[model samples]
Target: ATATATFTPTATATATATAMATATATPTPTISPTTLTVAPASGTYGGTVNLSATLTSSGSPVSG
Candidate 1:
C-alpha cells in the first residue's frame, strides 16, 4: 500500500498606515524698553552727577 501527502500554502497579508500631524508656531518676543537718566546730562569739569536706569520686560521690572 502507498500513502499520498498533501501540502497547503497560506497567503501573506499587507497593511497600510496613514498619519497627519500639525505644528503651532510661537510668536516672536518683543524688545523691552530701557530708560536711563543722568542728572545733568552734561557736566562741567570736575562736576559730579547721579546716574540711574530702569529696565522692564513684559511690563515687569527687572533688577539685578
Candidate 2:
C-alpha cells in the first residue's frame, strides 16, 4: 500500500495608512492710533486755519 501527503503554503499581507495634517496660522498685525493737531488752537470761520494729521501703521508712516 502507498500513502500521499499534501503540503500547504502561507501568505503574508501588508497594509499602508496615511493621516491628514494641519498647519498653524500666523497672527494678525496691529494698527496704531491716529494723531491730529491743529494750529492756532481756535480760529474763526472767516479766518484761515491749518490742520495736520499724523497717520501711522505698525509704528511706521504709511505711504500713499
Clashes of each: 0, 0
Per-candidate TM equals 0.43, 0.37
Predicted candidate 2 versus true structure: per-residue lDDT over 1-64, tens digit per residue: 8999999999999999999999999999885775443344567989987676656655666666
lDDT of 2: 0.71
TM-score of 2: 0.37
Off by over 4 Å in 2: 1-13, 24-27, 41-64
Steric clash pairs (candidate 1): none
Largest TM-score belongs to which candidate?
1
Candidate 1 residue 15 C-alpha distance from true site, Å:
0.5
Q: What is the lDDT of residue 56 in candidate 2?
A: 61
lDDT digits (tens) for residues 1-64 of candidate 1: 9999999999999999999999999999887676543344566679986566566666676777
Window of ten residues with lowest summed lDDT in model 1: 34-43
